[model samples]
Target: MKTISIFTQKGGVTKTTSTINISGVLAELGYKVLVIDFDTQCHLSLGYDVDKETEYNVEEFLNSVEPIRYAERGKHQNVSVISGKLKLSTKSLKRDSLKKPLKKIEKDFDFCLIDCPPKPINDDLGFGEIAIFASDYIISPVDYDAFTLDGLTTLIITLDELQQREKLTAQYLGFFFAKVEENTKDFKEAYRELSESEISSLLFKSYVRKNAFIRTSINTGESAVFLKPFSPVSMDYRKLTDELLMKIKIDAK
Candidate 1:
């Protein structure tokens, strides 16, 4: 299976939302997708509405214990989720702790998407590091704001450091704007600057436009792609997902 971590150093950039909708889109295409909620807040778990009924959360998966089974079925067919718990931050897990567990279930899924926390917790080599070490690819969802550049820089530095020190294996897919306000002057300027920068090649051609229905869909325990398929918000996600699939050369099974 190809494992991807939806990550960025900054929060409130729709990281969790992207993971949810991307999984929804992949599942819609008949891919067996597994989503791991690695954030301490457990927002991804809540988004899938699998928070309460799960027999085990991601904590057990990280613990590397015997007889552990945390994969909870998602609302969509061909989708499974391993819920996240708030107490996960306290665990002292090695940077590569998640790799082995995920490897065991590699053949069971077509794709594994991890919803990473905004920043490292517990220590420098925390959940974020663990997630990256276990992933085959990384995708960052950026926002149009003053801090966007700083966040992207930090993420790039972190990945570089990991590559040099830890032999990081994950390939950086690219960046796509999430919750974008395309009509605004600030967005236009930010997009232009990023497109002209040194990492310009990493900018995706498709983005997710800002929409009220995105938040409403998550709050109501459904992904916008499935909740309102014909809406602009849903269409944006579909286009973005399709673009990403093309980049990764993944076809529907």
Candidate 2:
């Protein structure tokens, strides 16, 4: 199975939204997709309509003595989700034990999409390195803002250091511009600035447009792909998923 981690050093860049939308679209296309919500906020889990009272959360699965299985099957389309609890990030589980739950679930799904949390304040590099180590590809959702770009630079540096130290093999699958508005002067300048930088090569051609439908869908516990399949935002996500699949195939070669 191929595992992709949706991550960003900065939050509020549509990381969980992208994860849910992409997973839903992939499942609609007949792929057996499993989404694991690793963020402490549990936003992605809520998007899948998984109730908070559910007993089988990621924390319980990781710390369980026996083989853990997901309680809810599929909510949005054909995609199954492993919900995250607020306590998942507070457990004393080791990295090896944390990895075991995912490894066990990987056998049942064709694609695994991990929604990682924002980089930790104490040690940004540690979380990025561990997420990269577990993923086959990393997709960074970026907002066209100065501070967000600066955060992206820090993330790139962390990934570079990890690759040099551990000889990591995961592909950096490029950035997706979230909440983009090309008409605005600030956004236009920000996009141009990022395009001219060394990291420009890592930017994806498809960008998600700023849309009210996105917020509405999230508020109602639905993905944009499922809420408005014919909307521009939905089409953008579909294109992004296609490009991601192509990149994965090329990387495998």
Candidate 3:
């Protein structure tokens, strides 16, 4: 199975939203996808409308020594979710702890997508490194801003450092712009700068446009793609997923 983490150090960049829609599109195409809520906010879990009262969550799974259990299913038959908890960041988890547990069920799904929290590499939360260590690839969702752009650089540097020190095997797949408002000057300037930047080659051609469907999806507990399949933003996600599959060299079944 291919494991990927949707990550970025900055918040409000639609990391969780991207994870949901990408996985949703994959499920729509008949791929068995597993989504892990690695963030403390539990936004991804809630987005899938997983049972909140379930006895097992991502934290429990990580901390438990027992056998692996079945994951909670979403509306889509092809999708399974490992829910997140609000207190996950408060606990101290060992680095690479998620790797072994995930290995137990690697054969069950075609792809595993992790919804990581917005925490810097050096932060005490430790969720960032844990998710990265467990992933085979990392795709960051970036916003149009100086801080967000700088955060991308920081992530690259951090990944390089981890590669040298911890022997991290996860490849930095590339980045895609999310929540884009193309009519804005900020968007134009940022897009131009990104195109001319040293890391321009790492940018994805598809970008998600800002829309109300995306904003309403979390409350509806469904991916925007499934909620409004023909919407422009949803169509953007489908194209983005296509590019993602190409980047990973995986054919949609």
Candidate 4:
């Protein structure tokens, strides 16, 4: 099975949205996908409308005395999720601790997508870093306005350092622009700059433009593709999924 982490140092960049949307699209295409809500906000958990009273959450799974449990089926048939809890970030988890637990359940799903938490105030490394260590590829969904030099530098440099020190095998897949407005000059300029930057080679051709339908779908606990399959943004997601599958050399069953 393949594993991926959707993370960025900055927030409000559609990080969780991208993770769930991609997982949903992949599931729609007949792939078994597992999405881990690695954030304390529990947004992904709410996306699938998982029961808040469940005895098990990410916090329990990570810090259990016994074996780590597998993610359970969500509202989507082909998708399973380990729901994040309110105090998830407060738990002190070991570096690479997830590697074994994920491996145990890897055979059950075709792909695992982790929705990483936002960077904490003082810590240099957190669940986001750990998620990458357990992934095969890293997708950074960036909101151009918030992708500041400090955030970019810290994220990039930390990845490089972690890859070396942790002996991790994951590689960066690319950056994808999310919540963009094609009509705005500022948005266009930002996209152009990102594509022309030194790391231009690591940019996905398909970008998710601002779509009202996206919020509508999210609010209703369904994917835009499933709710409004013919919408432009839904089509963009399909194209992005196609691009991602081709890049990974995985054929849809």
Task: Pull out the clashing pairs in model 1.
Answer: none
Which stretches of model 1 miss by more than 4 angstroms? 52-54, 64-76, 120-123, 250-253
lDDT of 3 by residue, 1-253 (tens): 8999998888978999999999889998889998888888888887877764464688777876575454545456788888887876646677778998889888989999999998888856478788889999999999988888888898888898888988999988889999899899998888888899888878988899998878787788888777888999889999999999998885223
Candidate 1 C-alpha lDDT tens digits along 92-189: 77777889899988988999999998884334676777888899889999987778777787778778787787799887888899888889998898
Flag regions of model 3 displaced more than 4 Å. Answer: 64-75, 89-92, 123-125, 250-253
Superposition-based RMSD of candidate 2 using all C-alpha atoms, in angstroms: 2.4
| 1 or 4, greater by lDDT | 1
Q: Score every model by TM-score.
A: 0.91, 0.89, 0.92, 0.88
TM-score for candidate 4, residues paired by index = 0.88
Candidate 4 has which clashing residue pairs, if any? Answer: none
The sequence of per-residue lDDT tens digits that candidate 4 reaches over residues 1-253 is: 8999997878788888888888878988888988888888888888767654474677666654355544555345788777787766534676676776788777889999999877732355588877887889888877667445347657777677767876877887777877878789877887788778887866788889898888888887776777777898888888888878776774223
| All candidates in order of lDDT, best leading | 3, 1, 4, 2
**For residues 48-147, could you state the per-residue lDDT of candidate 2 as single tens digits?**
6787556467667656546555544434446777788775543354434545666766778889888888874234233334555667888989997778
Clash totals for all candidate models: 0, 0, 0, 0
Lowest lDDT sum, 10 consecutive residues, model 1, at: 68-77
State the local distance difference test value for candidate 1.
0.83
Better of 1 and 3 by lDDT: 3
